[model samples]
Target: MTDLHEALRRGRARARYSQDDVGAALGVSRAMVSYWEAGSRAPNDRQLSALARLYGITPADLAEGRDVEPEEIDLAGMLLRADEEIDPGAAPGIREFVDFLQRYAELADLLGIPIRGLAQSPFVHRAKFVQKDDVRRKAEEVRSLVGLGTGPIRDLDPVCELLGITVYRAPLGADLRHAPSGAFLNHPEVGFSILVNLDMTPGRRRFTAAHELAHALFHSNETNRVVSNGRGPRESFADAFAGEFLMPSEGVRRFVEEVGIPPRIVDATDAIHIQRYFGVSWPTALVRLRQMKVVTADTYRELKHSVRPVSLARSLGYSIHPEEYEQDAGLWTIHRFPRPFLRMLRTAVIAELMSPPTAASFAGVAVPDIVQILGRPHGNAEQEQPQVDTEFVEFEATGVI
Candidate 1:
């Protein structure tokens, strides 16, 4: 009983919710919440369920006083545990993402499509500070796992989804100092998921997705959640993984050879070609080329100072529109959940397993918008079918028999 009270108090504290906040969310009073936390009172079953949902835990976890494992909890708990590493302003986005995952899982279950677990990889158990060669090898292994043979991954989101990793995009707002470009989580309930900042450009977003995917494949076992800010050794390894996974050495070499350019003379034009072909950022292309020795150090330095990629791509007849690289051109889709998840929401609505307003909240859209999109439920269309008087006319009589 003491352990249960302690667990409840700790859960609330870790969630960073005030007594008043919890009471408001649960439709109770601050005194009631305080009493519950103080072990002087206990919440009823309904309140306990609401509290568990708010704190991103199971009611049983609270009732049984079970020590919630990091992987067993949701993203909210994970974010709160890493509060020191992330900005306070990022909380809203994290909360929205947690809600999105919960809703996504619910809809998936309604549709009988359970969220799959993260595919196993040897790198999952490897050391965190792996060598560059080891990172490249892991990248190759992942590429093969995805059945991508040393080629540019035109779309990384679908690839992650193909490997049983749910990918979502949301605006984390701007917090230059402590902003994270992307996050990855492996939870027992939500399976594996990656959240890339919609604030980034399409190319950068793709890179971030690949980076988080690396963490999903490698560092997930060690840490249930990872927020990438492009710093530290772990981040460095993930970046390397993204570079190699997106543009393998052999693939780049083949591209350069196909371009009919010598290694020493490879310039910004060639780099732009690589960038466009590989669907990666220009700087990434330059770095990969430099690492592969396809361009001399002096040439790499010259290209680094060369023209901006967008202007160069335009001059080179390449379209710079967001749609040119991936389909995430507009960032206004309900919470920017992935297309696959949106489809699932639509299916849930049609199947009458979910309400329009609930689907709207999950989709980040208005109720009317969701209702308009979903229209009537699945059987309603059948019910609306036109009828004819069989006594007045028959099919054979109408057919002139």
Candidate 2:
């Protein structure tokens, strides 16, 4: 009985799976698996291999008791989103598609886990920063202090910069929005940041930034986990913040009054144009318009139903984004990670923090495919620790604090 119990506990947590759940998946009795994990016994070599495969991890990782990078602690986490039984490895056809959405949906609210948007993550802020300081309240004061005046819509970057928030552009996964730390603000430290799925529309990104900001301000005090349910009051508050922050009600009302434009403007570009003036996404603009009842529900439906998203260069001109852009040329989402992080990774060998081998472990290309999401950056940074500004990257800029 070589401390198998501790090993099993670590294994279970690392895999994000429950003991009984693993037992059911492996067609073994819960007691049997328990005994094996508890060190009273060990799984047979074949059984061990089976369990490792079930978790989509190497057997060595399980037996050696290595800390699966926070990102890999996803096997069990997937259950939150899976609408059906999740098969090991990738599934096929519609089953795979639904499973993917289910997992993504599950993560929408579980923000504490790793929903990294880029190859490298922003630096994970330590609890020490917040424990000695009253960070959350300070953050709230900071936002209120900013008192972003009521005005025409504006680009959000300046505000992010003003607040010392750094936005990270993450490759899109099934997860809709992300901020990577739980104690990101328990005391008011500053190493954590928010990461947005670059693949989302400007509309969605605008809302995501606001939602993340909410986490930084309000839930940053939550020392355990983070995730957003896109439909809750919490989310509604973020949307409201994003709307107000991007396009103040005063300005919006004034702009509409000035233009004397009523619900009849059938041109989508006009909507996009207005969003551009405000530095928001087309969808965000449309949704704002819809929310204001600026257009009839039928008109709103015509626009929402018109969106056809794609992420290839050849299709760029012919895609939904372009069509929407035709409606408003300023509709574009900005990528946050930029080229700097990769440069930091290259200097790693000099720093000696990451062994060449260790660095390769979390290499750029991994499961779920990173390239499909972030598009191609100038270069990939392998075996490098992500250096993100947690305050902004971890949550939205205008979310409830």
lDDT of 1 by residue, 275-295 (tens): 899988877778877877777
Candidate 2 displacement at residue 246 in angstroms: 2.2
- Highest TM-score scorer: 1
Clashes of 2: 44
TM-score, per-candidate, Cα-based: 0.70, 0.42
Across 1-401, the per-residue lDDT of candidate 2 in tens digits comes to: 22445656666554445566667667898888778766888887788777767655577766766555422333223322332322222222222222332333233223223332222122233232242123323333434556665554355544554554445443333333332111111111122244454445556665677666655554433221233445445445545555555655456667767766554556665565566556566567777777666777888888777744232222433224454343232222222432223233334423565444543333333322233133334344432225434555556666735
Worst 10 residues of 2 by lDDT: 180-189
| Model 2 residue 318 distance off true place after TM-score fit, in angstroms | 17
Q: How close to the true structure is residue 204 of candidate 2, measured as C-alpha lDDT? A: 67
RMSD of 2: 14.8
